[model samples]
Target: MKLTELADLYRRMLLIRRAEERLQKLFADGQVPGFLHLSIGQEAVPVGVSSALSDRDTVSSNHRGHGHTLAKGVDLTGFFAEILGKATGLCKGRGGSMHVADLSKGMLGANGIVGAGLPITTGSALAHKMQRQGHVAAVYFGDGALAEGVLHECLNIAKLWSLPILFVCENNGWSEFSPTDRQLATNLEKLGKAFAMKYRSVDGNVIADVAAAAGKLVGPMRRYPAPAILECRTTRVRGHYEGDRQDYRDAGEIAALEARDPIRLAAEALAEAGAAPDLIAGIAAEVDAEIEAAAEAALAAPLPKSADILADVYTPAEV
Candidate 1:
């Protein structure tokens, strides 16, 4: 990889890491409401794939979607404010942690339902294809979402119509509280084959590996009228949430995964490539400062008012 590209990827990964860490702390301290699904360990996928996308390309994310949005260049203050339900939030405090959306940036919002974003992404891809725009849509989901019939339907239609959509599955081995092994019967790649979709699996823990694999697959989908899937085998570095006792996770599993922290891995790669250690340290420090600022801003923002509850609701026009 080029030095410039590597530097950018390293910074992006660091941003996601620091942001998620700050959010986790805020959620645990009761500073934020609603359930918070973290993308702590799975940060590499979004940082890598999104780095390859232009501003025009769209992305639809899952419950664990904060990292995806951040990687897509969504505003930091607004994102933090949104999760805190502040008046200046991305959704103007109307949507909580799970329902954040920013249409201007092509983030179709984070879905609350399993497999919901797939079909939405398919439509975005169709829009691009119909408008003859050289753009693609990427949908990020977990392996558990594969159990949803909508994923299969979306893949089938996308393949049939040859939509410029990329289906990215962050196979972290668990779906909410249930382990993936208990839920999925068949392998995920097999389904992609059934749809005649081009597919590849990558080490989701490494940003370079992810970017290389995603970059390869994105070209073919754009050049032809086809859809593709990249299964990123990643892991969840933390619990499902702050409250869960993590009775499901094996002992030392989190610690072991921490050893493979994507940010650290990338920094090491940069260091080995003769990049200045102080440069990498400075990048990490910048991200840390951003996280701290966002946290303080989120904490100080005013809560949404009750009178504006129905401000966003709209009635249909007369027939």
Candidate 2:
């Protein structure tokens, strides 16, 4: 990787890390509403996959998608404000953390329903194909969705039509306190083979590797327009949602999480690539300051009024 490219990846990963940490505190302090699912350890998957995509391409994300939203270039201040329920936020503060959408950025939105994004991108991929837009559509789902019927249905449809879509699965091996290995009968690669679609797997902690793999897959999908899968083996450093005790988790795995942390891995890679320790520290400090400022600004913003709630609502509240 070029020094500049490595630096960029390092910086983006650091941003996601700090942003999630800040949001966790906000959720704990009662500043954020609704349930919050965080993708703390799995930052590299979105940061890397999105690095290979263009602004025209669309991304549909699952519940644990704050990292994907930020990686897709959503405004940082607006993202924080959105979660904080500020009127200045994306979606006018209606979507909160789970439903953040910036259509202008091709962030189709994050869904609270598991595996909902699969079918969404399947349709969007068809739209891109019929329109000849040459832009791929991708979805970020977890191992929890691996067993969903929608995943199988969308895979069949996308492969049958040769839709330009990337099914990016961040398999952290757990499905809401239970091991996903115990939940699903087959893995994504095997599942892809069942549908006769292409599939690739990468170390999700390695941002550079995921980017290279995603570029190779997304590159062809842009031209020939075919469906493919990229399964990222990752780690979920936090419980399924905020405030959970995570008593079902393995103690050994919990202790080993710090070693496999994505941010730490990226920073170490930057050091091996000749980045000075001070330089890496400076990058982290810069991201921390940015996150703190964004958090403060978001907290200070005004909340959406109840009387004008229908203003941002596109469809009729009573159809």
C-alpha local distance difference test of each model: 0.87, 0.91
Residue lDDT tens for model 1, 1-319: 9877899899988898888788888887888888888888888899989977877899999888998998999889899999988998999887767788888888888988889999999999999899877789999999999899999889989998999999999999988888898998887799988888899999998889999988988876666757889999998877776677888787777679878877778888898878998899899889889888887887788888889887769975679
Off by over 4 Å in 2: 315-319
Candidate 1 lDDT score at position 1? 93
**What lDDT does candidate 2 reach at residue 79?**
97
Q: How many backbone collisions does model 1 have?
A: 1
TM-score (all chains, Cα) for each model: 0.96, 0.97
Ten-residue stretch with the least lDDT total in model 1: 217-226
TM-score of 2: 0.97
